[model samples]
Target: MDYNLMREFADSWGLLAMALFFVGCVAFALRPGGRRQADEAARIPLKDD
Candidate 1:
């Protein structure tokens, strides 16, 4: 395995992929109806199993 080549690829493509994934997650979290889902999840720990 070539460490320098891998580092270059990660510095380019890996960073782009991470940025896209982060944006997608933020968009999903902010979408309509997300608050309702999040509220429901917030109650799970207090609910009877």
Candidate 2:
């Protein structure tokens, strides 16, 4: 495999993929019911069985 070809692919497509992934993660975190899930998770460590 040629280094230059791989570098070009990463510079273009890899960057786009990472950007899309970041946006997806942000959207998921902000989706409906996310706050409730986050609140429940926050109490886990303090809860006693």
List, residue by residue over 1-49, the lDDT tens digit for candidate 2: 9999999999999999999999999999999999999999999999999
lDDT of 1 by residue, 1-49 (tens): 7999999999999999999999999999999999999999999999997
**Which run of 10 residues does model 2 get worst, by summed lDDT?**
38-47
Q: What is the clash tally of candidate 1?
A: 0
Count of clashing residue pairs in every prediction: 0, 0
Measured on C-alpha atoms, candidate 2 has an lDDT of 0.99
Q: Top TM-score: which candidate number?
A: 2
C-alpha lDDT of all candidate models, in order:
0.99, 0.99
The positional error of residue 5 in candidate 2, measured at the CA in angstroms, is 0.6
RMSD in Å for all candidates: 1.2, 0.6
